[model samples]
Target chain A: MTDWDGRRWHDMGGQAAGPVPMESHDFALWEKRVDALMVLCGQKGLFTVDGLRRALEDMGEEAFETYSYYERWIAAVNQNLIEAGVYATEELAARMAEIAARGPTYGEAQDG
Target chain B: MPHDHPDHDHDHHDHDHDHDHGPFHHEGMSPSGHPYRHDNDSPLTYWQRMEIAVRELLIDKGRITAAEIANQIEAMDARSPTNGAAVVARAWTDPAFKARLLHDASAASREMGFDIGPLNLIAVENTADTHNLIVCTLCSCYPRNLLGLPPDWYKTRAYRTRAVREPRAVLREFGLDLPANTTVRVHDSTADMRYLVLPARPAGTDTLTERELAALVTRDSMIGTGLPLRP
Candidate 1:
């Protein structure tokens, strides 16, 4: 075994792993919204990208496997925003519950 | 903050302008030549619900606007490998600009009219005896302002970990095998600092125009996982 580097699970440098997966897909509308939100929120000083990274890293390795890329990202974004006091967890919970009741499709759920 | 006033919002109901719904949406390919991913009518997901909630909350609080979000999406969509390719092609043809790029990549890219904001970028050059590869082991940090969103593999755990440990093996898996004498250098991208590999110009391409040369540069080439296309 190699000497320990004290790396976190998300700090994956120089570790053993499988072959790189080459398949890729273009960003969808919702994914792009997540990306835009991250960028704009950072620009507005609501939170830094570092803060988002911290939230993602803290979510642990299991979340990495279970969550898709932007899923993890939106979670991190929301975490950071809540930490930044941009919105309260209560507000997010209420909003999500409201959203969940809207419809079964993304478009139908767009409006309140 | 420039246009954060609530009065500027066109209408809350008009957010669907970005989506093309229904049966005819799959008629043609996106600019990347791949079919568009099915969105909108797909079964609503947990994460999708969170996105809708967060976006609506942000808009409701006047922290952001729907128009701004739409504009931001359009701006990001405009950025792609093509932007980096143009920068690489220019560096190959213009010695002064290449020096500027190697010195201060962010400024050099700004000189070309790419609104990169405050990205601190570095340009690593690939030579006959030296090769460069980029990875973000800590997170999926990338030079997105210039190269658009990173490829999905770039954010994978396998590539992130293996690229730093066994670069030659990673390169080979990417269908790139450096000669025995060539030294391989791997750069780990960070939150504040991003690297763009200046892939070496393919040989026998002296007669090609800048635009033609740009076409030969691929996304993987800029990331140093693959080389520019041969003429």
Candidate 2:
């Protein structure tokens, strides 16, 4: 698949070849893709909210807190995207509310 | 009393050397022109601090073992370089591969035996007539599975600020000056997905093996500020 610029994508070992343009709407598509991946992985119990909390504790309070700030910043960006009509407003609001209800607990409201 | 004064003077001189600065002339200066103070601002919020404390309490209560945590770090380190190299090699050898990567990066990466997650979100963008740069505007939400720990600058506020507003200028600062015809695309990696640039391979690498090509692709190149290694 070529990107918008019309470059071709080859598989590993340089053996396969095809043309596909990258979507102009990649950011929106990626968000949807990740949301799906999160559900799939969450169902498999690979990345649990509680597990992340424990991991943060192991990394120490300073690092964990910095990570939390990072999460908040991303959430704000998602909110902006929703405002810009880049994301679904209803979904964004629901997610934001869910995060808020988690009450700033370990790995509760924080996941990018 | 007079003898004590001399002794005190010597003691003060010793203290000055011990602090690694001569007798202080300015509150913020240490003989060097640079400020001698470190900013101690806590980057975390109050709630985050409380959460960390609570989590630690849980761990102490036997919820998780410290060894299990160490294992994660070991796993991450092992995964980082290989994933990075694979992406670089694929980009170098296959144009179609590069296209796929730019289209659906995570899936493409997985096909190469690499996982692009807890942040499975991936976006691939390309620039030829112009250059594109990537920065995690919020924090360093990098493709760590592919790239190792992001360089210090990637995580710095200076880079985040300049990368968006003045991308071309920032690239120049990194010693990457594109042709005037090149348009600069600056991507702010936010919540939905993160991005990695598919840098064009450098010349004179036609005969190199895939492994050798991978070695030439540095993390900075994927970030779009540096070129692949030469020779």
Candidate 3:
């Protein structure tokens, strides 16, 4: 498991401490690797569409409907993976659970 | 069921008709119906009404001043280009700096004197054979520090809906068509994390200075819907 530092985590308004430096090539490689992991997690049902929707709601984002929510969730998950490092996978999973808990209680009308 | 009231003599002979003249027409109206007629006079959607109510409450409660919000908008309008141009110029001229930008965009932006905040998160991605597009599917969470205020079209629900679902078609509407095989990655920003696209440097103009290179980077290019300026 990645080292969990509660103190390092800040709310959205807090300042970012910057990303861990790596060469562009290395970073790209890592991104691909992480993307593969997310795809696997998604396929295995560890990250459901509902799960992603809930997560966005937890973050105070209300514009995401079902389909859009899933797509945006994947992007957010990938971002979290990159920023938190692979060791924080468990933490990411937990965050997803938190989101799912707050997922839309009622169906939303599809916007054209 | 037919009943005749009166009968009149009909003449078959007719004068020359003026066919060129047509009935007067307005821009949005059709001859058959009034385009502007509506059953209700409501001017706001549920979400729009909610947004207005919330903003009004915030003002009334003194949680946030209207002037402060306006100042933020003014600041965004002022500082957006600096961030976008700086990123593009650095990426074109310095490979090391580009690498840093790809790894962490907010930090790179800060180095250029732009503070990226008020977002829950920020992520930057790059592509060579592929192109990346940015949209806030949920709300307009933009990299205001880099690109200034997002264009009005970006805030429309149509753009938010179509950009993610059919990105290639959307880009085509914007007059940007990538090769059929070119990969298209759409990044959907939310209230949390904002995003900015790092467009590939265009060919030619190797002799141009950083400022000149920056000039070539347009706001649309950073959004991934348009290419860098040619000259």
Candidate 4:
């Protein structure tokens, strides 16, 4: 599906759509962390921004509708990192489980 | 479909957190006058968990450092519409710089000591006869290094689609009514190149200093959604 030559779901140019929503919000700490990782990994030559975009596109339209911007971004960043052999999915899953057990809130879960 | 997150609550809350983690302080607005997002107080989300895991894995592998990550975040925070405003103001005043900016935006921006960091930037000039609008039809490919992060609207599917389809109507919604004779050129930001709209200088601004002129340049003007503030 990533190879679809027709207008992909992510490709919204010239398509009929509704009014532009103008509300904006400041990035949360965790969201900023996700953004930093994306930039740092790209700077480190581990992956290109295009690779990140490709991963986001491959995640399909459902993600664009359901997830928040940074959520999708972290997913794409993780996907690219895994594809780049930076870490195994098993390692990621284990770490996630460990984090989840730490606390119910983000403050308690993150390392000091 | 457009995914919309509720605007972050501006009311300050007292959470049960004993101590702050990392560089984020949960008090007051950031230096930029924007309120900090309530991170520690929010419930741990699945995506946040993924972010923590990925960041930790990258750190464990010695691929990136915590300090480096902090520094990068700080750098991005430092970038805002002010940078683009300064550039627009400079172009408004200096003909030579404007020519250089219109010729090569990245170089001109770097010449001003703004490290745009490998972003292929293009400067589109708006004249009396023509106006320029920018949209990333494929994704939100904005000139972020210059203008900071794209606004919430810029990344929306409605904007992404209609900006190219009916830019005039879109601009009208933003309260900008272009004349019928003006040609609207919408720049679709692709994977490699980003665009900055060099909005036409407003009249009666000849006496204003570069800094003062910069104040007239709004972020939406640079994005071509709205005009520069009237002097």
Q: Provide the lowest-lDDT 10-residue window in model 3 chain B.
A: B1-10
Question: Every model's DockQ, to 2 decimals?
Answer: 0.51, 0.03, 0.02, 0.70
After superposition, the stretches of candidate 4 with alpha carbons farther than 4 Å from their true spots are: A1-5, B14-27, B30-32
lDDT of 1 at B112: 99
10 residues in a row with least lDDT, candidate 2 chain B: B1-10
TM-score of chain A of 2: 0.25
The predictions' CA RMSDs to the true structure, in order, are 7.4, 18.0, 21.2, 2.5
Candidate 4, A1-112: lDDT as tens digits = 5766687799879889888887677777787789889989988999999899999999999889989889999999998989889999999999999999998878888762
lDDT of 4 by residue, B25-62 (tens): 44566645776766676678899899889888988999
Q: Candidate 1: where is the Cα deviation over 4 Å? A: A1-5, B1-28
True contacts kept of 3: 0.00
Against the true structure, what is model 1's DockQ?
0.51
Cα lDDT for residue A72, model 2?
Answer: 34
| Candidate 2, position A65, lDDT | 31
Largest TM-score belongs to which candidate? 4
Worst lDDT 10-window in candidate 1 chain B: B1-10
Q: Name the candidate that leads on DockQ.
A: 4
Clashing pairs in 4: none
Q: Which order, best to worst by DockQ?
A: 4, 1, 2, 3
* TM-score on alpha carbons, each prediction: 0.91, 0.52, 0.49, 0.94
Write one digit per residue (lDDT tens) for candidate 3, span B83-140. 6877788877988878778778778777777766544334444466788888876555
Q: Candidate 4, residue B134: CA error in Å? A: 0.4
Return the lDDT, model 4, position B59: 85
